[model samples]
Target: MTDEELAISVSGLRKSYRDNQAVAGVDLAVRRGEVFALLGPNGAGKTTTVEILEGFRQRDGGDVSVLGVDPAKAGADWRKRIGIVLQGTGEFDELKVGEVVRHFARFYPNASDPAEVIERVGLSDKANSRTHTLSGGQKRRLDVALGIVNRPELLFLDEPTTGFDPAARREFWDLIRQLSHQGTTILLTTHYLDEAEALADRVGVINRGAMVAVSTPAELGGRHQATARVGWREDGQARFEQTDHPTDAVRRLSERFGGEVPELTVTRPTLEDIYLEMLGEKEEQQ
Candidate 1:
């Protein structure tokens, strides 16, 4: 699919179980070949929303389309073009890593080469190892390898790096970047704000089953243009001020000091900071 086309679209999506609403009137659109991140605290309905799009669950009310076909009415061919890496690990513990990936590759009409897939996910060295013997990070890589074995045009990654260490997370991010470069549309949900900032082209924040905001990481909650906090040492104590124009503040400070301002620092809100503030506002509103 071309980058301009929408891979998935949802409008007025609502799901309720008896008296509790899991998803409440949500609208989302994912562009082809883009890495879109859905961020929110637990119980924010992110899982439910993704399930609806994946055709695994029924929605109470909404118009949902995936790859130009309504997910609720999608056929086998429609399903073939998508891949899902769920929160849970795979269950082929007894099989070798290559055996597991090769087995899944058969399910798709046109699958990637098993060896190539393993190498792509950085599992080449462990390709002969048994799945049960792999470490947590290795197991997660096995999951990813299986997910893309089908060569799906769209992929869903739900907390794929949950058990990964810092080094492993960085390596996984590189793998994701390679997939995106190949024009694979991805929908990612993760608790790591830094991951979203590093990988996503755009981010959508959902809270209490509702989307609070959608924008680039820098622009979310107007963070890119938000007031900057300037701090410096003065009279043996730290003094700080917030202003929209930090350049002017720095210039003034420099003039006052006739040189560098001691311990000077200018900071803007980070993605996590804005995200937490948005969640706090949502709580206050309720």
Candidate 2:
């Protein structure tokens, strides 16, 4: 995409703490209105890379640009254009939900209505509730409310759904979709592979401070091109085989059985499968 079409761009990003090389020669680019997911295991430098992009931490070397300005040189105005929802809850336990949201809105030049943003995050019922009284999931919703109160052009979400139940997670997924639909650029970092699969337009995987792969959920780790596993039960025994053409295999099995193949299943590799395979390969290399 063109320069005007990009929200974030980085080249050869490097960072270190003493002898610990957290990020090494990383390159990343995010479009103006896309939900990009960064997936990696613990200590894979994902947090370091994101912190550098968010201007919270400085890098050791290489170029970095966010919203057309170097994050290292970004000022208050630059910050107003970006939103951040960290992995932990905000320290506003003494304040009511609405109070917290309204307080943050004052920091931005053109902030959204605190009440509207609170309702947008499904927190209207808790508007008068103290921040400390909220359940874990409710606190997370408050975090999201604060993140979008500025109506930012770009949002950074680091494990935003960590404390949610399955139903709450699904609801948060819908909220994320709504934001992406409204032309907000989102950079997400999450440990849940399924969350990335459900929400991201594109995903980049990092390992040991290096980028391993970047692709759509369906095609990552060559998953789309990988062989399908066909399985069936025959004569009181279970059997399965990997084949390029699952349909052909199933058809032949149907004919052999002279009818529907009993307990037949044709399945492709799942995202978790592909992810583990990639990690295993990386470990072998080390």
Candidate 3:
């Protein structure tokens, strides 16, 4: 894609704190109108890299552009074009949900209607409730509401569903898809592999302060080429083998059992499995 087509671009990015290097010669690009998921282990420079992109921290070296402007030198107008939902919830104990959303809506020039934003995030029922009285998942919805209240071109979501239950998480996923469908570019950081698999057009994995790999969820770490595990019960004991052709193995097992294979199953590596392998966590096992 052309430079003008990208919402964010980083080349040879570097950052360090005292004696520790948080980011080292990293590179990344996020296209406009795309959901890009960034995954990494603890202390893998994810936060530092994001802070630099958000203009909350200065970088030591690199050419970084967000919305065609250098974030290191970004101004108030530039900041207004991007929205961020941090990991922590806001402390608005005395304020109603609608009041809080309306207050934040004032910060941007092209802000959306507070009521509509609330409804979009599935927070319409809590619009009149006190912020402190909302449940954990509701608070997260409010956070998303505030983030989109600006009608931002690019939205940054950091651990957006940390406290959500399974059902709530699915609901939030739908909300994210709705936003993306509305032409909003999103940069998502999450520990949930399933969330990344569901929401991201492409995912980038960072390890040891550097980018290790970037690809579609299905192809990362060669997951599509990886072997599948075929398992079945044999003599009251489970037997398994890794094979590229699991269907043939299953057919063989079915014939041997005269119509059915007891406890027969075939499974492939999940996104998390490939992610861990890419990060070299699986190497420790070897």
Candidate 4:
């Protein structure tokens, strides 16, 4: 896509601490108004790369652009267009939720209503409660509230749902959808493969400071083209086979059984399965 279609652009990104290369020649692009997930195991260069994109850390060498400006040199005006929710709680001890949100809103010129933002993050009930009294998931919601109070064009989320329970996670997903509907671009980093599959339009996997792959969650690592495993019970035994045409295989089995195939199952690789396979292959190459 063209530059106008992209919210973030990077090429040959590199960062190092002494002899340890935290990010080694990474390249990434995020399209405008899309939810993109960056996935990797701990110690991978994902954090370094994201920090560089967010302009929180300097890069050793690379061309980096975020929202049409190099983040390294971006001023306050540019920062106003970008929002970031880091990996943990936004600890504002002793302050009530409403007070914290109102304080942050003052930092942005075009801030959203503090009360609306607090309610949007499902913290209206906790608005009067002190920050230190909030639960882990509630704290995360507060972090998100602060991040988006500016009504930023691009939002960066690092493990935004880390402490959330299952229901809370689904709620957060719906909130993300609402933000995307408002034309906000989001870059998310998470260890939860299922969350990535559900929320990301595309996912990029990183390993050993390099990109393993970048594609839509369904098509990543050719997962959409991978063969399906068809299994069935037969003559007091179990049989299974991998086939590109699972429907044809099932039809043949049905004919042999002269009716519905007993205990039949057709399975394809899940996003987690594909992610693990890609990581494993990358390790073998290293």
For every candidate structure, what is the RMSD over all alpha carbons to the true structure, in angstroms?
1.8, 1.0, 1.7, 1.3
Higher-TM-score candidate among 2 and 4?
Answer: 2
Report the poorest 10 consecutive residues by lDDT, candidate 3.
277-286
Candidates 1 and 4 compared by lDDT, better number: 4
Model 4: lDDT of residue 19: 94
**Tens-place lDDT digits, model 2, residues 88-130:** 8776878999999999999998999999999999999999998
Question: Between which residue pairs do clashes occur in model 3?
Answer: none
Clash counts per candidate, in order, are: 0, 0, 0, 0
lDDT of 3 by residue, 58-142 (tens): 9999999999999989899997889899877877998999999999988888889899999888888889999999989899889
Off by over 4 Å in 2: none
- Best prediction by TM-score: 2
lDDT scores in order:
0.92, 0.93, 0.91, 0.93
lDDT of 3 at 172: 92
Clashes of 2: 0
